[model samples]
Target: MSPSTPQRPRTSRRTLLTALAATPLLSALGTGTARATAAGDVYASNTDLYTRLPDGEGTDYARRYRRHEMADASTEARFPFHRTTVLAPHGGGIEAGTSELCLAIAGYHPATLERAQADGPVHDYWMFEGIRNADNRELHVTSRHCDDRVALALAAGSLNVLSLHGCTAAQAGAPASRPEAVVVGGRNTDFRRHLHEELRAAGFRTVDGAEVPDLGGDDPDNICNRTLLGKGGQLELTTELRQGMFGSFTRQGRAKSTNDTFRRFTAACRAAITRLEAGPDQAVL
Candidate 1:
């Protein structure tokens, strides 16, 4: 993985959000622009920057709580490496369901990365790294820590990536009845449509451009859209659906056990990916 970028550090929550909302479009418009730095130890540049730290709370808690050690690939093997990448940026503890989904979808794919806890809990993105995969390459891990490496692997080529993230229904202003909805985003039209269709066919609701215009994945720098090939897909699964998949509401890294919903959902995702790889002539939907 490549080294992290150095730039201006963030001052406050408002400033951080403002930078996030503005940087993508600005990056898309300009060929070469200035980079933004993150506040404190963490450098916020791409898709892996979010946490429970409130406005006033300092990074002390995050610093003291998280253990920043790269995993030993040989001991803690997860998935092999392939051209297709599956990532759970907010895995470990930042987001509850992401790591599980990423691993479930990865199945036997050699190119999958998830943040797993070694000793204690870890929400720090900069510290996350992957074991050496089938390709014998370790992921640079955090975008802030190793943007260049990740860029080369996923963002710089024609690689297809599937990113799983966790979102709240209340945050999206979704109706109570649609708690099992998975909001589809990213620039890959075919993959996005397949995700929506597969999720719906698996008995889950979907919210896309028609319902949530703001989360339409138009931003070029978004981790999902940052694929080297051109575009990729992002799935923001709701808390309810995640809970159904894991059969609990814990913030643990991986599920100790899983439910039928999890199996069905993963199967649907795999089937969609299979069809996607089969080319347009073999598209199931």
Candidate 2:
């Protein structure tokens, strides 16, 4: 039998209500009262940006997600429900290669939007992308402040979350001589270790996020850590690393062209998730 409509068995009514109530207040404050990051972001939260921007999806911005259904009684004996989720809050032009990486890490092909492997595991995913002509950086909503209802609900319902982000080599404190690197952060120590090991094994440079004070994703409120286990992992890829993953680093190019580096990185991430899922920490969501 085919899978039924996606179920959100873990998103409680209280959680939805709390998210709905908090979003509008932030949006209503407008840009004036919104806290500006060191990068000079104007919006307080995703709700603030969504309220101010034109309602033009597929043009200015887009939101996409997928939550696979649980197996029925007949299939449950053979298949297990995926408890992990991958996220890209600053995808498309905002962070370049993150959107593509998010899809690939969640078991989909970035170019074709199909399952990367026929019998491979497919985890849940959610991405908010900026498809604008220019100035997409203004759309960024930091992870701690990301209040998109769907993103929140999806995260709340999952046991693990793997959030993807892009950062400058300078921000990551990578040596100028060799700048291609990824910083692994978030509150989940086991998840972070797995990611670091897998990425290093795949020939990618990995850094401890604690070395960069600002990028340390240890905040309990950060979206990636707001999972069923109340902890998750975050990967911050440097610009050099992200750019090398695509042949032409434009919005259109990212969707159609991904090189070997991209494949290797995604494969490493999936391997880490698989390790986490099979480990003893696989909490019931």
The numbered model that scores best in TM-score is 2
Best by lDDT: 2
lDDT of 1 at 135: 15
lDDT of each: 0.50, 0.80
Q: Which consecutive 10 residues in model 1 have the weakest lDDT in total?
A: 27-36
Candidate 2: the clashing residue pairs are: none
Q: C-alpha displacement of 195 in model 2, angstroms?
A: 0.5
Residue 73 deviation, candidate 1, in Å?
Answer: 26
Residue 31 in model 1: shift from native, Å? Answer: 37
Give the 10-residue window scoring lowest on summed lDDT in candidate 2: 27-36
| Model 1, position 110: C-alpha lDDT score | 13
The TM-score of candidate 1 is: 0.60
